[model samples]
Target: MRNLEQVLAHAENHCENNGSRLTIKRKQVLTGLLISDKALSAYELIDFCKGEFGETLQPMSMYRILDFLNNQDLVHKLNLANKYVACEYINCNHEHLVSQFLICVECQSVKEINISKTVMTELQRNVLQVGFHLVRPQLEMNCICDACITSQA
Candidate 1:
């Protein structure tokens, strides 16, 4: 994985290439997620901005910024947790189909992983068989992390 500075620079370049600017506030929000070890809700982001940068952000405004970041694929929203995390593939140059995450139930640690094309196809087929549309095509699995399990033992 690239360092924070490297990732941020890549994101800036990506946005510019796509004709969208990564504004200061959006950058700040992305920075907050990058520095965090787990997903964060919008309210938590508001507090983070206020504490770290001494800048107050309204909830609605934060949501709008988050929406933009999500659309830009700079960050991803965890539907199950109602929180956001920076995309792990932000620095990658190749296109990827992001579809799943492993979330540590005990520690809230998040790890992004790609599923095989065959598996994705099967999952989509199953959803279609049930007469439900897979709109997001994302999955979040809950499990105990190694650290958490070791500590428990």
Candidate 2:
């Protein structure tokens, strides 16, 4: 679990680095995400914001916040689950990339892992050999985790 204060400070620094201001609403949305362990959908986030601010947030507002978070690399969209997970490396300086996620279909748990550099290089080489350029790779696979398998057994 991440320290909420640290996460907020990191978010502020990130905004500063990008010449942006971290607005109150954005901070609330980000704080909500940082405090939760599970990935949340936009609707879930909206509900969270409503409960936090004592006012309902429009879907458009939630989308705008999500878009900002995504662009800032503070959160990642899980295409398989149609949800968003806060990136674990909020303080890291490396540029984010589209990567593979190991998803447990039974328990709905997700783990994100980067593609090996060698594998990416090989893929690029193979695609070039085939007279094609790889733009974005969407790789999501369903599998069972150890805990899930043990629970089922």
Task: Give the whole-model CA lDDT for all candidates, comma-separated.
Answer: 0.90, 0.80
RMSD of 2: 2.3
Give me candidate 2's TM-score against the actual structure.
0.84
lDDT of 2 by residue, 112-132 (tens): 788887887888899899899
Q: lDDT per residue, candidate 1, 1-153, as tens digits?
A: 458898899999999999999998999999999999999999999999999998899999999999999988899999878899999888889987855888888888899999888999999899999999988888898878899999999
TM-scores for every candidate against the unseen true structure: 0.94, 0.84
Error of 2 at 11 (Å): 1.5
In model 2, which runs have C-alpha deviations exceeding 4 angstroms? 94-98, 128-132
- Tell how far residue 102 is off in model 1, in angstroms: 0.9
